[model samples]
Target chain A: MTSKQQDKDIHQYDIHQKKGFSSEEINAMSQSVLNEKLDNIDAVTLSRLHQARQQAVDAAVLRPSFLQRYWPDRCNLSRSDHPILQPLVLVGLIIFALGTGYLMSHTRTDQLNLGQGEYLANEDDLEVAEDLDFIAWLIEQDKVSDNHAG
Target chain B: MQAQQQRNHLDHFLARVERRAFHLAQLATGQTQPALDIVQDAMLTLSKKYAHKSPSEWGPLFHRILQNKIKDWYRHQSLSQRIIDWFGKKSSVRDEPDDVIQTAVDRQTPLPFERLKNEDLRQALNMAIEKLPRRQQQAFLLRHWEGFSVKQTARVMQCSEGSVKTHVSRATQFLKQQLEGFYHDQ
Candidate 1:
């Protein structure tokens, strides 16, 4: 036989020759030893240990550990409606609405009457009209005087 | 409750293995209390996580935990001692004097040496078994002491069957060499 085959044969023989417990003996001994161990271990200690372990597992299942619960805040939001952008958008819309309401009421005469509150015009408005009339009268008088001089 | 049955099974499994486990741990740690603690810690871990694991899985799992605990103990000791040594203080720790005296006495005391001499032979064999390298020791214990199959031993050792065969063969050869005097004198 080849050297490899010889080695294999020797390996096989060594195993065959090695002393080992028989299957029946092993089963009997294992069972007896296990039973003896169970008999000696404190039952109450074991029961309490079991209950505590179950409780821990239940807690983990109910609320995952910090590591398990983590989802990146950046990835959780999409472009349109992130929590950060929401408040600024709402404030901007309110400001825009207020500015538009003020401009619309100022431009309409009927709405301006309500803005005037039963008085026809405020002093600022009367001042602005008077200034316009003075400038126009000055221009007309200058035209007539220039005609007469010519 | 299903878990409870699994734990019960695990308790039984560990109980079956505890003695040899203690002996093996004792061989590695060279002390009883540390070995016992390691075995207990291993038992607790196995019962908690791998209780539902099979009988075939228990042997290796227990050993793995025991190995890890042993490593941790050594690591902690190394760091502590290194710190102490760095400060230039001589370690005041001493070996257990009682154990030394008891072993010395045991050396002189004869068992019913004539009638049950096989006990001596068994102990010699156990010592030789213990002296093997850790992997070989584990392979010997699992394959011979625990009566695991070669496949089961491989599974526990987390190695291929061929590696298991080599370890067991090397272990048996070493044991035979170590105990040849006892075996032949028998």
Candidate 2:
């Protein structure tokens, strides 16, 4: 028969077979036979299978670790390697330095102002200044009296 | 921790499918060593490349990989045979004595399935499956044995769904004819 006719025959037979037996029954039969074959595999092949499994597991373990998944260039710390983090760190350092310098300058200016104000307040001690002036006048009067006696 | 979980998941998937994968390869190649190699290669490739895929996707992905590996083996076999033929022609060897001896032995010996009159139905079924054409065997096994849907089988076979159905239909018809008595007795 021609190939096309043969194909048609096969298709017809396939339909007949399907109608004759349920698909579930055919599937179950084939599955049972295949399972039996799987169960009856030799020990040597089973050992080989175990070895293959272990090797596959090892290969998987050797793949990029979880850390590599998150930080792909973790091993490299160059600025070119970390485009985002490099600029962020640089900007952070600059901000911190500027903040520290501003704080120090402000604190020094406050200390200088406080020191000058305290010195001026001590110079403006009214009672002490008055006493000093009165003593100086008394000395002058005594000196004049001595000179007149001389 | 995540890597370990992925590995465990991959291991579980491989353990579940390796036997059936081996059987499929054996059916395709009709040899133990090549089937073993194919299964190992498929397992390793699936683990290394697709371990991060969801567990639900691993089944179809691994089957696809296994089928591709089988195809690769077929290509390699054909290429090597071509090389051998070229060398044989260069050496002006018209016929190898081994080929003649093998052909003689093959003509004398009965096929394994032909002796299945008193054998188990399972053996007869397996023999018949092994004797099927590559595409038909793949379709039958993948559809009936592995329980893949027609769409999934098409994806795995890299063929249209209609072609998958045709292959499966032809395979079922052939198998039905071969195992007619066995199924009838059942």
Local error of candidate 2 at residue B172 (angstroms): 0.7
Expressed as tens digits, the lDDT of each residue in B1-186 for candidate 2 is 888887888888888998999999988887677889999999988878767656887787898899999999989887777898877843222122322321132243234332324357767777878889999899889898888999889878888899989998887777777766765565
Error of 1 at B60 (Å): 4.0
lDDT of 1 at A56: 31
Expressed as tens digits, the lDDT of each residue in B124-182 for candidate 1 is 55566556787777776667666778876775666789998898778766766665455
Please give the distance, in angstroms, between residue A74's alpha carbon in candidate 1 and its true position after superposition: 33
Docking outcome class, model 1 = incorrect
lDDT of 1: 0.58
Cα lDDT for residue B84, model 1?
89
Error of 2 at A103 (Å): 51
